[model samples]
Target: MSTSTISLDHVVAWLARFRELVTEQQSYLTELDSAIGDADHGANMVRGMNAVVEKVGAAPATAADELLKSVGMTLVTSVGGAAGPLYGTLFLRMGVSAGPVAELDGAAFGAALRAGLDGVVARGKAEAGDKTMFDAINPALDAWDAAVAGGADIAAAASAALAAAEKGRDSTEPLVARKGRASYLGERSTGHLDPGATSSTLLFQALADTVTS
Candidate 1:
């Protein structure tokens, strides 16, 4: 594997790693969600990612976009609650931004990630400090871009993104919710980690593990 580029195989491995992480952290995710939102975030992610793996495994995609589009669609149809649509739109926009490429260089990968974040914003109306997935994803993408701008390879960028994402996820603990079901809690939402942010951090951690392996 090229250190500076992401291939379709890399994407597949990324999803696989994400599946593993989410499965391992399922109860933890549900614990987080139970504090401020519905308790199904963990189960929903595991189910969605399982369906994603099965769908992508059965139908081989020649292009990154095709593979991810399939993943987005599967999540949309299979997973319930806000996670479905938000995560679905993220992958959907990533695929669209990635186009029909067989490989994405660092810059292209960052662009795809940015597009995905934008799609999530468009779909969920989330912003900085919303105590949503955007909190983790936005900082992660910014770190990714910065690493790439500093001439880091894909693996390095992914590591930076994961680190930033973890920080972002932790930062959400003290924030009052302003979006999603968590928002319904108002100030009561404070002191609990955002399940979306925790899962979103796993997403980046999976990427880091995949590219560095």
Candidate 2:
């Protein structure tokens, strides 16, 4: 399969782009969460990403695992509520799977992503149709795998992942929340899009931006 090789530089660039996107969209995310959640998804995410940016800038990590592990640990400590642990686990697993590598091809990156998704599932105890970030993340990973299998490069695969993530995020609107605080609202959660799912889409979109730009 054809692949786009992603270096440590690309990983750093991706994180920076993700931080900017999350910061810019913070209020929108908070609004979404206010409908059915603790209403701090935006604040928590922005705070965590800002910490990540600060850490990265202070002491740059040349190895892939070192950089991602730092991102994971920062989120785990700083971000509040469910988003923190879930995203922290995602990065932690990805870092472990990435080992000490300096770069990854599309296939290797896909494996790392699969590990991250698994970590989310394990940490969140959620699955597809749970009306959570898993809805977006699972579909994006699937699409990324399929795209790579179909010979798509990193940019194309990331684009496909973003598209699938959007569809997954949209799919959550009609779902009755089955996990997290949103589940407390039951049927009231129906018709409102999940903040977690929306944020998950933003994550994939940032990943795509790293390649496209």
Candidate 3:
């Protein structure tokens, strides 16, 4: 596969892979959430991603922005809880940053990812160590930028991002929650892995799979 640029097909595959992963891990996600939240993270993500894939399939998009925006809107409307708005904001901002394009080069994709991360922060008001999705996403993007700076192609960059995301996700396990429903547990949140970070890891894993496969 050519790594110089990622096309709309790549994006669509990424979403499909994400949906597959979330469905496979739905029970694990819900179990993690049950320990620190309302126990709906897995089911909500599965439902949302299923809707996103269906919506995208129904309305074929000619451009990256159009496709991404459709995905964002579908998730926002179909999913419930914080996951809907935060994930929606991420994809919405990414689409806006990508503009009217059929494909994205490494730099363009990285910039769009950064924009999405910033949007997530704005929507969730989460920072590093907040034990939220930001922990995983931020580090993942940082590694992405670094890989791009080293002239790595999309596959390599995505691999780097996934590794960083997993590390960040693991890092969340020891921290006391400072945001979202987990925060209510205080010290009780210390031992369980964060549902948001875990799902965010799946997001990158899907990206990696799409590019490498």
Candidate 4:
């Protein structure tokens, strides 16, 4: 368990991992959406990630924050629905948190992620137990923070974060929606997992896998 610094290469690698996972889980995300939303969350994320990959692959920007900001802008324009704004804001805030030309270590990465989560909260105004991505994301950030505070290595901290995210994603299945379009269904939203949370979990998994890899 050695602590390592995060570099621009790591950021790009994680984005690549995210692209792969989103593509692989597209149908799964759509299925989750079919239960609660417009049924396009998966497709939207896939489309957005594809655009992001293409952008990142073509030029390979030198600046990590600029690269992430580009990703955020691409998603904002390409993706539709709350996913567009929420995910866009997350990346945008992450880019801002990382700043220009600054290296991010395990603790810095955790802090950046927490900042991104705060941006999500500001943009979506959703909280934990709302049957939204916030449920997964918040717990994941908390776990990351706790693990990092406990002197866990980046890999171990990220693993813990991803596990918390997955559990939070699963927990969404039994809860009635308390936010977003699904909330409109009241109790009918029960028994269906939130598509947003599922995708968010995938995002955390991608981060953990990329960093560990």
> TM-scores of the models, in the given order?
0.98, 0.97, 0.99, 0.96
Every model: Cα RMSD to truth? 0.8, 1.6, 0.7, 1.3
Scanning candidate 4 in windows of ten residues, the lowest lDDT window is 1-10
Candidate 4 regions exceeding 4 Å error are 1-3
List the pairs of residues colliding in candidate 1: none
lDDT of 4 by residue, 140-169 (tens): 989998988898888898899999999999
Q: 9-52 in candidate 2: lDDT tens per residue?
A: 88888888989998999999999999999899999999999998
CA shift at 26, candidate 3, in angstroms? 0.3
Candidate 3 local accuracy as lDDT? 0.94
- Which parts of model 3 are misplaced by more than 4 Å? none
Ranking by lDDT: 1, 3, 2, 4
Count backbone overlaps in model 3: 0
Compute the lDDT for candidate 1.
Answer: 0.95
The numbered model that scores best in lDDT is 1
Per-candidate Cα lDDT values, in order, are 0.95, 0.91, 0.94, 0.88
How well is each residue in 54-130 modelled by candidate 3, as lDDT tens digits? 99999889998999989999999988988999999999999999999999998899999899989999988898999
Question: Model 4 — TM-score against the truth?
Answer: 0.96
The per-candidate count of clashes, in order, stands at 0, 0, 0, 0
